[model samples]
Target chain A: MPSRDEIFEKVKTTLVDALGLDEDEVNGSSRLKADLGAESIDFLDIVFRLEKNFGIKIPRNELFPESLFTADSGFAENGRVTDKGIAELRTRLPHADKDTIEALAKDPRIENVEDLFTVNMVVNFLTAKLNG
Target chain B: MRWFWIDRFTEFKSGSHATAIKNVTLAEEHLHDHLPGFPVMPASLMLEGMAQTGGILLGESNQFAHIVILAKVPKMTFHSWACPGDSLLYSAKLIQQSDEGGMVEVKAHVGERLVAEGEIVFAHVDDAANGGAKIDQKNFVFQILRNVMDVGKAGNGTGA
Candidate 1:
């Protein structure tokens, strides 16, 4: 199995190419949308590139869940994510910073779910899949 | 009637999923207008093709009782370029459906390589309920759809 550093390198390269960003823009702490300006369309491009580069098949709702953060998901209340929601997110997003998440917790916009995706989150997800 | 982005449906299942095909050709007028030298199919058009495939599936889900229209594309992304002579296979799976609209997951591929994938949302509008001018050519739309989709295998002889 590749070391975590090697996995991060591959994930970083894929992000740079998929989003057309400079190499320096991608790092462990960089948020995919907030820092990298990745749009809705770019998410598919990123997933596709990752699948091809890693030789894995990512289902439609695994990496970026389709219905997990919706209004009826029980994670959000009045457009804000509840404590229960954050707990659920923590499991799915192991690589995101707790401080960053807490900062955004005051008024989490359900539509801004992409904001929670950091470079490390993807690396972690891929690592888990590879190991499994 | 405007030309459809998808050529025909190779596989279709009502309210579940559908698969269609589109042949990219150099003779297309849109290709000439997209780029002077590069004769590749526009990514936007590929997205439209996905929407068309899903829209048809959604419309048929209710037997065309309402006019289904592409309302929004929450997510759409392209992984590779599709050139002329490439056979584009489009697959759409219905996620949820209601009286108002429906959601679908759509993807496009060339052989084994996935070229594009996204989610398309379509609104089912009851023109009569809204007091809007109804489409007199509903039959025309149905006819064209029938010509493309293999309604016999879909188990809905009426293309529903």
Candidate 2:
């Protein structure tokens, strides 16, 4: 199994490839919508890329907001943002929460973003199934 | 272009049935991206076409009382790859129906050659609620399909 940092790096890379963003723009702190300018269709394409890259099905409802978030909520009305939004972002990370996701994002042991998202998603899914 | 369909229904008691055709053309964009020179229709889209045909069949069977949406494609198999300039035919028959969901068996063929076959499961849904609903047979579904297939006529049969 890959480390969380590696998964994060992979996820970052996938976001870059799927969304067609520059490499420098992707990081643990990078906001998906605002900084990336990803739209609804782009978000779905990102999910498809993640699923194909990791060989796991990420449910659509889990990745996108139930409804579009407004600018008043701190997410740019157009859907961009900062590291603070990372907390809410965890809820959409396939099956992750704030603390575990934050640890993975911050973990120096991780090397790539792909492994981070994959590991986090798999572990979180497994843990949820085991506990639930 | 080629078309593939499962079965041909000449006549039915209550439910509705229909046929589908797909024209495989060199002009299709996916042909280039799927492979360098070898082009095959994406299986997912083929399944979608089958589901669309099936949905129409079920809707017509129940007289359009409910709209049909594909809830799942649990199992699918591709016996042969359809290439450009081939015509594919798909025929579907309603296996079962109820207030919840229904199943249909669809087959695809290129001329007399069997290309692919699979079973599609769908739910009868209300256009308003966008979910499952009970079907009413006396409405529009059966009437539409009967007219399209031209069943009950002596000489009109599925023409391969």
TM-score of each: 0.50, 0.41
Residues A13-126, candidate 1, lDDT per residue (tens digit)?
Answer: 888776767898898988787899886556665776677688887776678764566655799898777888878877766656677677667667765566668888788888
Q: Report the CA-based lDDT of candidate 2 relative to the real structure.
A: 0.57
lDDT of 2 by residue, A31-87 (tens): 455556654445444554556566665453554453323445553323333344444
After aligning candidate 2 to the native by TM-score, how far in Å is the CA of B41 from where it should be? Answer: 1.2
CA deviation > 4 Å runs, candidate 2? A1-132, B1-16, B127-160
The residue-by-residue lDDT of candidate 1 on B1-160, one tens digit each, is 4657888788889999999999999888988877778888999889888888888888888887767767667668899888889999999999766565677889999999999998776665565535566666545443365456653456556767
- Measured over all alpha carbons after superposition, the RMSD of each candidate to the real structure, in angstroms, is 9.6, 12.0
The CA-based lDDT of model 1 is what?
0.77
List each candidate's DockQ score: 0.03, 0.02
